[model samples]
Target: MTTSDGEAKGEGIHAWHRQAVNDPNPQTLTATSAGHARRRPDHLAVICEGREVTYAELHRRSNQTAHALLAEGLRRGARVAYLGRESEHYFEIALGCAKSGTVLVPVNWRLTSREVDHILRDSDAEVLFAEREFRPVADRLRPVLPGLRTVIEMDTPGSLADGFLDWRAGHAETDLDPGTGRDDAVVQMYTSGTTGLPKGVVLAHRTYFTLMEHMTRAGLNWYDWHPEDRSMSCFSSLHSAGMGWFMVGFAAGCTNVVMRMFVPEEAVKRVHEDGVTVMQAAPAMLRMLLAEPGATPDAFASLRKMIYGGSAIAPPLLRQCMERLDCDLAQMYAAAESGSVVTCLAPAEHTPDNPRLGSVGLPCPGNEVRIVGRDGEVLPAGRVGQIHARTPALFIEYWHQPEATREALVDGWLCMPDAGYLDDDGYLFVLDRLDDAIIVAGQNIYPAEVEMALAEHPAVAESAVVGVPDQRWGQAVKAAVVFHTDQRATARDLMVFLRGRIADFKIPTQYDFVDDLPRNPTGKVLRRMLRAQA
Candidate 1:
């Protein structure tokens, strides 16, 4: 396949030329299964905890799962909550729910029982497919969720709870009637917001397939993937990247090596032993793997691609990963609202010689990106502003939040509240979250910019910047820093160093040195935590 320059030409300027431009009908399990069968029937589709499931077997099990749900009187459009660690069965159940026209709500396994209960109640889930490991927490909340009618234990027949349904017994060797088309909602992903509550992001079959097609066009070779190509994902399927990337692998008929929990040593060992060719992880995971004692390049020799995203990658770390890992490195930039990948830094750009070292690459073939000021005026190249995008894969709306949806969607474009700039060559450089912007003595200071500068210091391992209350400046820049190998630096030293690199006003006024910074599982810094500490 040849790469396009991604330039607009005449009337076709708005269309994504490289992406799978045709709209696929809402993808039911049957369609996905058929696609798999036609592509590679005998190929391995999933491998969880050393157990393998072929594409044909995956289809059969999904069919049975759908039939079982139907036999249990699960009406069309009913919300079914799936709570568990990443497993082979998770994908099957999710696809089954989609085929049955039921919304699959996969809750984050790391979430506390209270968070779990809130999602279940908020989504109005009728039944829950829960893992035995979390049975205690589920049981504690079962009585509180009035909308929850039943619980299905995902364990062996004899291990299930007394009143709960056993998933093994529910599986019927029968095909289910595939329902609906591309516009139907398949998954409702809950993402925590700045306001402290989580909101459900509704993704339909059309949007999901649109993203998949976009990935394929961007050089994800589904046909080239082999049944024995061991793929591993440590990110929870509850997140957009986790679910979306896993789906892409499944659609390609690659074997998915599941990690119930993320352990750096275990992940490294899995790659070497399983012949893992594809791996998706956050920068924190990369940092952990790199930090492992005696870790060598050969540890990841089997990997063909190492996908890192969810947060900005420090330049030093990126360089280390390129030098240490014997594989291609791709950077994905996306959001839950965008379904999945919107922009990607190809493997070629991962080299140290590449000029666009800090950029997140050009806009996806079919997607149009622009930097706009607060007044919605488009900024010229190299000017920092809010990033806005228009794509067919954009989310329909924030679930049950019409006003918020209206605020986000303007003239068919999603106004992402991320501060960034596009270079002359169209490469995007994200500065920071708009909400985390700090105003110091009337000048705007983006935390990411400062953190990036701080990361350049040899002593700094990680850093997070926040605006804290101040009497004189109204708000002052405060940095929370984690150092490498017990290396220490004074706040005055950092401020002095930053003063030479940036504006004097943008230099951090205070510093709190620590062992680690608070972050989400995806490696995204939680600025709220720093603000709370302040």
Candidate 2:
């Protein structure tokens, strides 16, 4: 098979990509409740802290929430915002919005009042479900955001709330469906762009369903789920991957063990006590988990698979996770706009010294990957270009941003702002984000490639590479590094070690010793912050 350009297509277009088993498939996001409530009424749906919610409870509570939202004058398709950390209530609001045909917009609790206001106003959300801790911020922004009509305060667990719970309890618990279809938008997720302002990526119910169908149909062991599997949702729902992960578990009728926050020590304790079998986390989170004193083979004994992504992982970190955790490691490469995990490094590919470890692996079923050059021409094998994908699970559009939408969705392909190449066997090797590339003396330098070299150094704990203004070369490579607690290294030592590891120009001309690299809530390195500081 070949592409339109007459070039041999990647492994993503293989014959088996269309195969499917004769199992029932959910047609909408609301099926997470509507489908599961009937199948596993008494089974545990969500376990958070000391609280447990069964499938029946989730359905009933979320239905009550849906009735409340409609009763509060929220029309179908209206944006409903949630400003709080992950909790059982958050899922209720999410599923309720899905049931009521209101798009769920999860605000990053870590954002400032101003940033939160921007998202609320930008999304034009009518109803805001906020935790008591963040009520002050919500109150401060309400008068300014005229579109924000209702503010329902969510109380802590077991407390009779005068706001969220009380209002929800007043509504009917009977199932109320608003006729949300597969094409209806379920979530309007805001992602920080290069401009630093949040852009809402509106995802439809079909986004989740399409990905699930393809993954299930392919019969891939990379990310399978079972009803008895106790999966962990450690990442925040504001992160799309976290939301998708939670939905995947819910749709599979699995018992989700929720972590209100990602504390390595606490995570180790939960895995040991709860018998969690499958979970996903970022590489940084895995590193922290392995660093904990209680993190032993026995601690993760019941864990069968660990799916990781969010950023490019260093080989040392990957090897550490494979060795210390002693479990199957699957690496996913995806963006919110492209659904989740278009490309994945399966467990079998996690070999000790395999070169394929550097690649993000072949595309998943019903997904196509292509490398396009600056001139919009399709690049041949082994040629570096912008990575693009045609996936069945692509987001609808960036809310109200027509120009941005047109720019992102080109010729039916979701454009990823990343630079990479495809090998002959169709393996994708991601260098780094094209915007993060440092141009030095007409040579393109990718930070991930340089950071990979720095990881080879024994004393380097973590490092972030960024471009600094150079009087001679326009831009010079700089690195901010954190060393191991018991070890230390000099800039000269690192430079000497990286001399032959990567291109000389790609090596950092200057270095800063820091306690840690700045990261977002999702554990993605804030390279823009590093560049601003440099």
Clashes of each: 3, 0
Off by over 4 Å in 2: 1-26, 156-162
Specify the highest-lDDT model's number: 2
User: What are the runs in model 1 whose C-alpha is more than 4 Å off?
Assistant: 1-29, 156-165, 168-171, 212-228
Clashes (candidate 2): 0
Model 2, residue 225: displacement in angstroms?
1.0
Candidate 1 C-alpha lDDT tens digits along 117-204: 7788788888898877877877888787877887887865464232232454556755565567766788888875554667788887
In candidate 1 the C-alpha lDDT for residue 431 amounts to 86
Judge candidate 1 at residue 278 and give its lDDT: 83
In angstroms, give how far residue 482 of model 2 lies from its true place.
0.5
lDDT of 2 at 33: 80
Candidates' C-alpha lDDT:
0.76, 0.83
Clashing pairs in 1: 16-366, 26-181, 26-182
Root-mean-square deviation of every model = 4.4, 4.8
- Residue range 450-470, candidate 2, lDDT tens digits: 898898899988899999999
Give residue 332's lDDT in candidate 1 (0 to 100).
Answer: 79
